[model samples]
Target: MINPVHLRTLVEVVRLGSFAAAATRLGYTASAVSQQMSALERDTGVALFQRSARSVLPTEAAVVMTRHAAKVLTDIDTLMAAAARTHESTSQELRLGIFPSLATYVLPRILQNPAWRKLGIELRVSVAEPGQTIQGLRTGGELDVALVYQVGQSGLAWPHTVNRQWIGDDDFRVVLPAAWGIGPESKVAADHLSDMPWIMHHPGTSDATVIERLFASCNLHPRVVAYSDDFHASLEMAAAGLGAALVPELALLHRPPGVVVLDVPEIRLARNVFALLPKEQLTAQVQLFVELLADTLHKLGTTRRD
Candidate 1:
């Protein structure tokens, strides 16, 4: 194989028209540069220079080899640059999974945060609810971390390889249409909801299972008028006076018109949001993001105080 160092020396020597000049630029002795050119010539089995007392001039073959060497060096540099970019993309990228409802509020906050900017990380997000997010963590090599929520002790599956940390709580609130004659600040009693029409989640979903049990535990079951997993749809249904719906405080960040958010002191059904990782170990970016996210959620909760 042709030594790239020798070839490079040859190119410089040819461009400068003197071994002494090339050696000066490369910080090598003139004799060393001459030896490198002589080895290069022996490797190629061709005379590379015509030596005379007046000057050492490049032979036709040497000029041609220099041209080819420049092109080869350029291609090698391009290849090395591409390899470096691929390494950076793999090392500095973060893959995150979150729920659909959270994508609407939390995602933008996480992306736009100054802390996120400082991390110099590229984020790739996948929107899936808790159960699906957990499953993805188990089998999906692409998922590095996840933001998920669980309603008090409700069963969730996980392999022993995962780790969980509580980030914050998203408290559920009673949403009533303006026609309900209830002020937004007024506390609604549990007993009053009995025999009242309500909007609920479809059966078998994680949220629906927890919410159904919550109402059952309170000994209050209302007539179900609509079933939807979409918080926005549920909010719209409640605003249309279709029925009352239970929604998380975060879901109300964009509080739609015609619906009043009320406190249900008799019920406490807050979903505990958590950060789930493949293992307990966290990269600097992930750890910083978790801290910033907790701070953001705390500020949001404080601002929405009833």
Candidate 2:
């Protein structure tokens, strides 16, 4: 293949009309420049110069090659500039993994905030559960940040190298069918709920274990009428009078009309929300995003539903 370096040297030599002068401009010895021109001629199988004892003159072939070489070099420069711009745009993008409830309720608020515009980050979001999001933070994973929550002793683990920051808390609210005569202002005792039909998390899962233990502590063994992992589905089930359900405040943002959220002091538990990042990926933009997300969550948590 013809070398681009050789083409560059040929262009210089033709333009300068002297091997010694081309060498001076290119930071090479005159003999080195002559040797390169010879190699280029061999590669192209065309004579590029007329050599005499005093002068090194460009042939017709040399002049034509130099003209084409200028265009080739310019194209290479343009390609390099385009590649650099692509790299800059990729660097400014943030790959985020978040759970469904937060994505549905909290994320929209953050996006609406005026502060989010100033962060100047292009978000590529993946909506999944906490376990899935944590998996996306492992080595060779696509996510740069994960927003997850932890229920009491409901063990969720990530790589030790991952960095964590406390964002906010999502307190669980006990929701009952309004037809059951439970009012929103009701302060239901845990023991009174012992015989109530309940929609619980699927058995043996991290969340279910914690909730069952909490119920047992209160000496209230709920009769499980249905099992669901999705808080939205659970809320709908409760609204349909299938059973009472414990749902996070985030999920209560759009509570169905037939459900009444109660304040159960005996079941005072909350899922702690956190932001997870790769140790090396904790940039200022990512931190700002987390801060905005936390602020949004706090506002949502305090917003009352009629």
Candidate 3:
């Protein structure tokens, strides 16, 4: 392959019409410039210069090659500039997906994080559930990063091409209507809910599936009063004295007015929140955002406990 450096030297030598002048302009010795031109000629199998003892002259071949080299160099410069711009664009832009509940409770804190502004990442978000977010990662190239959660080993379908980093766990707490007289900090047993009216996620969702299994494992069958996929909506139903619903710790960040959070040890359904990205597209900004998210989750957990 012809070296671009030698092509450049040859072009300069042809343009300047003297090896010595080209060497002076290029900050190389005349001998070095002549060696480069010789190497280039050898590589091309064409004599690029007509040489005499007193002065060197560019041959027709040399002149033609110089014109082509000038254009080639310009093209290379343009390609490099375009590549740099693309890299800059990637660094500045972030396409993020978050579960609906996280968007409500955690997204504000993420936006408020100083690191978010310091990184200058422009975010575009998709508010979706965990399953939908995972599907988006597989089908759509639009998302650079997705914040998704899995309820235990809920058998959620995730693309193999995605890489996951565990951000944190969202512990599920049973929320009952205030009128039901369940103390906010009281530990409720799984068997205690056998006959209670329950507000749950749509039956087929990862969350609902896990909750259903939890009930089955405890040999308790509760009557489903209402079904809602939205945590906020489920919380509203729970608050209205309709039934109890399993809610994540993050969702409880803005605890509804009429609901009391109960501790259910036997029903241990903690959803693991992860930062999922297409393996090939994980950039520094995305990694930093994941780190910031984990930190934000920790701070939020602490604040809630206090």
Task: Name the best candidate (by TM-score).
Answer: 2
**Residue pair clashes in candidate 2:** none
Model 1 misses residue 306 by how many Å?
4.2
Against the true structure, what is each candidate's TM-score? 0.68, 0.69, 0.67
Ranking by lDDT: 2, 1, 3
Q: For residues 1-306, what per-residue lDDT tens digits would candidate 2 score against the true structure?
A: 454445556667867877777766754446556667777678667676656544443321222334444554566555445544554465468899998888898888778765566455789999998999999888577898999999986889988888989989998989999889978787679999998899999998999999999999998889999999988899999999999999988888888889999888889899999999888887545765776677667666777444
Clashes of 1: 0
Scored against the true structure, residue 40 in model 3 reaches a CA lDDT of 67
Q: Any idea what lDDT model 3 has?
A: 0.72
Number of the predicted model whose lDDT against the real structure is largest: 2
* True-structure lDDT of candidate 1: 0.73
Please give the distance, in angstroms, between residue 228's alpha carbon in candidate 2 and its true position after superposition: 0.9
Candidate 3 residue lDDT tens string, 213-299: 888998768898898877788888888899988888877877779998877778777888898888876654466567667766866
1 or 2, greater by lDDT: 2
Q: Candidate 2 vs candidate 3: which has greater TM-score?
A: 2
